[model samples]
Target: MLAYILRRCFYAIFVLYGVATIVFFISRLTGDPVSIMLPPEATVEQVEQLRRALGLDKPLIEQYGIFLANLAQLNLGDSLRYGEPALRLIGERLPATMQLAGTALVLSLLISVPAGIISALKRGTLSESGITVFVLIGQSIPVFWLGIVLIMLFAVHWTIFPTGGIGTWQHLVLPAVALAFNMIALVTRLLRSSLIEQMGSDYVRTARAKGLLPRSVVGKHAVRNSLLPVITVVGLEIGSLLGGSVVTETVFAWPGVGQLLIQAINYRDFPLVQAIIILLAGVFVIVNLIVDVLYAVLDPRIQYK
Candidate 1:
């Protein structure tokens, strides 16, 4: 298991490298940052001099080499627009993203677990039908749209919460719900299906035939086996959310990594953009590695070679 984990950590490095490479090139292709930086009436000389100062005058290959070399030393360079270390900016914004993502994850799990189990237990009944409809609607709603609607209802008309920005729990309510909407539906449906399938499995039948309590059989045996897929979704969702839910963050004006990324892209801040993407890719790789480790714990049948 340790060897497997070490191998995955090794692969994670390549994943981060690929992400950094792609983002570095793609950011440049969007447009030259110097163009936006200078005034319209600026002379060619001013643009060229500014480019040289920013090292944009260097060949693309040389820039890439510099980027990789900096990356080796864990240096993400400075944000072009912010005039601060890119890594430092990311660190400042990370806690906000973490707060939002954590709230969303908790909301998703709180709503999904019981809903999924009950929906499975009461299959072919009204409760199941209601849960199905709810999941369908939740999945169908676009996150950005949901965020706007929630603001209108909860913040504008009702005045129950602040419309945007972050501070208290009131400010968090709308955006978190909007971000969690699809995840809740996705987890609930996945868990429901998995539990239903597990209920029909041979082991489930054996547990029943042995006169075990129905609740125990369902909870201990079926739910445990059904959880692997749920865990995978949860792991991925947390990573994605932590990376930043761009739409939800934008809608709520939440000062998070997602909002920062949008600004960075708009300004073509290459160092900041690259830093954010690489960090997001690293989060995904680490979360997936954790999920793989959990598989062995959840089901000992899964053994690392």
Candidate 2:
């Protein structure tokens, strides 16, 4: 297990490097930040000074080398727009994003698991059909549109929650629900299918034949085996929620990393953008690693090399 973890760590490092490289080169294609930061009345020498100050005067390769060196030292550099440390700015915003993502994850699981289990048990019933339709609609609707509709219904029309912003629990509701909509649909459908398949397996049949209670057979014998895939999907979704919060955050005006990322992009803040991308990429990598480790715990048969 230690060796397996070490291997995954090495792979994660490689993936982060690749992501940083791609984002670094692509950000330059948007043109110079100096041009965007400066006014039309600014002279050529001012632009040159700004460029030198930001180290844009250096060769691209050399700049990348410096970036790597700083990254190795856990220094993400200063935000060109805010003039604060990029990583510190990210850190400031990280909790809100995490709160949003974590709330959404919990909401998705709470709705999906029971719905999936019941739908699987009910198969051809009207309740199952209704659940299927609900999942379809949830999956089909765009998150941004859903967020707007939720804001209109709950925040505007009913005034049950705040329209946007982050301060209290009520402020979190609409955004979390909007962000979780698709994930709930996905998990419900996947878990339903997995449970249905597991229910028909020989082991499930054997457990049933042993005169075990139906609930015990389903919950213990069947559910455990069916969880591996669901866990994988859930873990990946949680990671995606961090980055995918962009649209939902924008629609709801939530103060989170996604919102910060949009502002950074608009200002052509290369360091900030790079930091956000790398931070999110690291999150995704770490989540998947956790999921992989969880496989062994969930199923004893899963052995790490």
TM-score of each: 0.98, 0.98
RMSD of each: 0.9, 0.9
Those runs of model 1 whose alpha carbons end farther than 4 Å from true positions after fitting are: none
Writing each residue's lDDT as its tens digit, candidate 2 over 1-305 gives 99999999999999999999899899988888898899999999999999999999999999999999998898888999999999899999999999999999999999999999999999899999999999999999999999989999999999999999989999999999999999999999999999999999999999888999999999888988889999999988987898779888999999899999999999999999999999999998999999999999989999998
Clashing pairs in 2: none
What is residue 269's positional error in candidate 2, in angstroms? 0.3
Over 1-305, each residue of candidate 1 has an lDDT whose tens digit, in order, gives 99999999998888889899999999899999998888999999999999998999999999999999999999999999988999999999989988999899999999999999999999999999999999999889988889989999999999999999999988999999999989999999999999999999999999999999999999899999999999998998887676547778899999999999999999999999999989888888988999999999999999999
Q: What local lDDT does model 2 show for residue 257?
A: 96
Candidate-wise lDDT, in order: 0.92, 0.93
Deviating ranges (above 4 Å) for candidate 2: none
Query: Residue 176 in candidate 2 has what lDDT?
Result: 96
